[model samples]
Target: MSKSVPHAPTSFRELEAPQRKAFFAAWLGYLLDGFDFILITLVLTEIANDFGLSKTRAATLVSAAFVSRWLGGLVLGAIGDRFGRKPAMILSIFAFSIGSALCGFAWGYWSLFAFRAIVGLGMAGEYGSSTTYVMESWPVHMRNRATGFLLSAFPIGTVIAALAYGVIVPNLGWRCLFYIGLVPIALTLYLRRSLPEAEEWQADVGNRRNVSTSSMLFASSRRLPNAVLAIGLATALVLIFSQHTAGYGWLLAAAAIAGFIVFAVQVAGRLVPVMLAVMATVFCAFLYSWPIQSLLPTYLKSELGYSAVQVSTALTWAGLGYAVGSCVAGIAGDALGTRRAYVVGLFLSLLFVFPAFALPAGNVVLLWALLFAMQFTSQGISGLLPKYIADHFPTRLRAAGLGFTYNVGALGGAMAPLAGTTIAGRVGNLGTALMILAGTLTVVVAAIIGFDLPARIGRAFKADDEKASSAMTERNTTRAM
Candidate 1:
């Protein structure tokens, strides 16, 4: 038996038709994921008015969706690992598409929540399915660029939602917005006909069949450090829960203690570089960026007295910035390294994001510029994930590993809307809450950099293609015998 690793395509045209179709399918699916979710944000006020709910209650809908994404990612990620990305992707699109349509008929808060949860579950798999499909299909050298293009969909869909809502909601109504989500069903059909599974994935499937879903990172003594790291992280989570449950303002205390605890655990645990890589991307990319996107519309409409159309305009501009920034970050990450690029972009975000929210919101140009820079910097840092995911995990467990990183991060993101609204409910201003959150997140990211976390993660990289090929060859030989 023999194994082979192919060279990455030098240009987009070099990719085969199925590979090209898979790329487009993944991008469109990713875009629609943003579209469906952001549509909720755009219509939050109308829904609140119809249902007689407070801002906090409306925000809870967003939280519910995020919480469910954890389960969706875990389940679908395993499916992707065990079966194929195309199937997982197809199912996920169906779930979200149906869920979005169901939302149009919802009469009350609970009903909407249930439907949104369905959408969340479906949306959750995109990170594992489409991302893994395209990333694995492309050559490793283009990893970050492909991810940038894919991730750029987040902002593009958001922008479309913003603009579409501004145009459609006034003319047709909020329910009409939900109907628009049904459009992604077209993508599912396209993917079914045209998409191709990654060769790398096909090669490794046999070897990955018996892999554990629960605590896969802890299956060996050599992997015990990852176990400790997981435990330490869990402990940190418990501490955060206790502090938050006790009261606000204890987060700093909890975070300080949790840091020390993680350090102690690392000393005992020898945490895997890949795990740290995941944490760095999670903290830097998702934690700060998501809340701004989810809750900013509320702030603009309620606090700043902007019309719905105006808010949509601002968001559309920002989303465009994020989309472009994703492309630029892809290049920068390769040059400066992902972590360093993240540190720089994050710092840039700290400069404008707060002002984008805190400043007087009447001037469209000023708001657009600030928001563009804010989203560009914040979302740009996210460019780190593609490269990291491609580099860190083996082919056998790639989807699960990617899903775990993304969904676990979404766990924190799920809390963002709730936290923002709760803080706004307390202090009477969303701006204050956003500033507090953004400032705190910036500090944490800076501190993480100061601790030299990126260097540790960087040292841990190994290319998986050859090993994956060998695994496939070994499996094929055994099966034939």
Candidate 2:
């Protein structure tokens, strides 16, 4: 007879030493994945200079990476569901690490693009497996908080990338940046040695060993909902992209529409209105923040005549803002409730984005301050969305649902840089682009407050909080006895 594996941990503190270690290991690996993905963004101008390519072509390289990530999410999510999360994580880490190393050696745009695609493929598996592993291991009450903690790494990864580029790229060149990117391969090896198979995944593997992969995610009854979620996510992402690309004005409008649509749907379903409201808030804040994020480094380089290292330093500070925001959001989600925290953070984001856009480009200090405020709010609120999605699904289909939804959003995000660059290139100005993005975010804010703001958050958070509190109380009482 199969022996019973230990039950899932009921609280963050109750997680055994081994389990906590594994979680941190997985978290770091995911963080590195984010770093590898965004590294190219920081060094885009350098790449263009070296390769003699246009900005659009350089942007395509970034887009290709996201496309690869989308494909990886689709394919690897299924694999994670069938094979097991641990193995998938190991393979993904290895794939991305090797792919990043190859990027350093690329002789042409096409070669670098191919390597980026490979990295995306590797990254595809990283989130689904890791998120699933963390979600499944934690107690029900702690699920949202735990997921929030894990996701907080995303901004941290970006900060690391910014720092690396800031310190290394000016002196060593952009190719060396990719060479440094290979350090995460050692991380992959460490994960392989340290992380045990997720107990939940092992059980899932044993029970469903005979089931076909497609049937697992796309069963006849579940197909409709899955398709709906995917479509919704894709639509939201597209709107997000349009905003990021066109201008703050466009982004604000898109965010408003998205928030309104999300609110309307949740209201119709009698779900939490706050959930949609918070999402809208985040979309708006992020729209205001994100354009400035990637654009600032380029702006400093081109308009202000700053060196690559100076640009990278500015980028690092922005990334640090994101990291701090994410960490704060994670902690706040557990304490203030996910919806409240998201709303507050998003409001702050909106507040920052508007004034920052109003400042002249020559005012670098003011611009950085605005960007930091935007990122802190946007990234902080973003940390909660994945956890919210994960909390909504059951274990069997968790990875697929999360992967599909996220990638759809990513697709939208991927489009933003292209749109932004094209518009700016055509207009011969970045001001218009910033305006459009900010506008989109404003719309997103309106959508949040008017639409479903109470029901969905209530449903998702209440169940999770209740379970977590009960578990912790019982554990404490047991110790007392």
Residues 436-466 of candidate 2: C-alpha lDDT, one tens digit per residue: 6755764564355335343345555553443
CA lDDT for candidate 2: 0.64
Tens-digit lDDT track for model 1 on 234-316?
44443342234356436644553354344323221233344445555564545566678788888889889999889888888
**Tell me, what's the RMSD of every candidate?**
7.1, 7.8
lDDT of candidate 2 at residue 230, scale 0 to 100: 49
Off by over 4 Å in 1: 1-17, 206-208, 211-285, 446-481
Return the top candidate by lDDT.
1
Per-model tally of clashing residue pairs: 1, 41
